[model samples]
Target: MVKSKPVMHKAGHLFSFVLGVIFVIGGFLATYLKGLPLIEQGKASKNWPTTKGVVLKSKVASHRSSNSNSSTYSAEITYRYQVEGQNYKCGTVWFGSDVSTSNRSLAQDTVKKYPVDKQVVVYYDPQKPAAAVLEPGVFKTTYFYYVFGWLFMGPGILMTGIPLFRWLVRVGRGTDERGENVAGKF
Candidate 1:
């Protein structure tokens, strides 16, 4: 009887390896490109010089998602401050940009925190006086992107490592071109 040669399949393993590598790269990019900068800005803002500012207008802005029935809410707070005699108006509450929450009360609470005409401490960048924030330094939200990036990295590591481990095991098994076990053969 003639024996049919075994077919060795490495495509699946190669695919896994490629996918894993892509995930790892994506995770790193997310962390470094998006998360790290926000964190750094948050930390730096803590020491920025402060000035007196007044909330000109504070309101809740609603954003409806195009692809879904859901909506998000954020506090639209506009304030005015003076730096080196130049008057500037800014809407930034912090360095991470306006935070949107699904809960309306959250945005409402933010608006309440800075009601119209209320005076607040404004932290301004020395070099660029136009850049300023009401609440400086790192807050719980500051870690959002940083944590998200790491979340991707964890799965990426698993995806990458598993394929690599399997490839190593297969190589160690010493399979012939026909994928037959050749470990004990000459």
Candidate 2:
């Protein structure tokens, strides 16, 4: 009787290792890109030019969704400032570039900080003078992206580590190259 040599396939292990590495890198990349804007805002807050601006309007704009009776509020503020003898008006208070919010109190609090006719320190981009903001800071919501990134990366690391640990420990007693135990097979 002739015995056939068992084929040792490593495709499954290779696939898992490759996918795990991709997931880890992809999660880190997504998180890093999401944080770049916040970082830029931080740097802008410190370096952007400061000028005097007068609040033309300040109120919490309310919106009601058609699907439900629930309403949302957003801080709608407008301010005017002069840069190099040119008049400019802008509505951005921070770099978030959006004002829609489900929380009314938070929006109201933001509105209260810049009451109508109140004078505020405006930060303006030197190259694009029209772009301006009353407040220079990162949004609280950005932290969620960081948390999610770590969440995704954690599982990816585990997926990669398990196989790697198995390989490193040389726990391949009677196991095929696929990293599966074959001792109980026959």
Name the candidate that leads on lDDT. 1
TM-score of candidate 2 to 2 decimals:
0.56
For each candidate in turn, the TM-score is 0.73, 0.56
TM-score result, candidate 1: 0.73
Q: Number of the top candidate by TM-score?
A: 1
RMSD of each: 5.2, 7.9
Q: For residues 85-170, what per-residue lDDT tens digits would candidate 2 score against the true structure?
A: 99999998876534476888888888889899998899988988898877776666535455666777788898799988776665
Task: Write out the backbone clash pairs for model 2.
Answer: none
Candidate 2, residue 132: lDDT: 80
Error of 1 at 129 (Å): 3.1
Clash pairs, candidate 1, are none
lDDT of 1 by residue, 35-134 (tens): 8887888899989999999999999999998998999998899999999899999998976557577889977988999999999999998988898899
At residue 101, candidate 1 shows an lDDT of 70
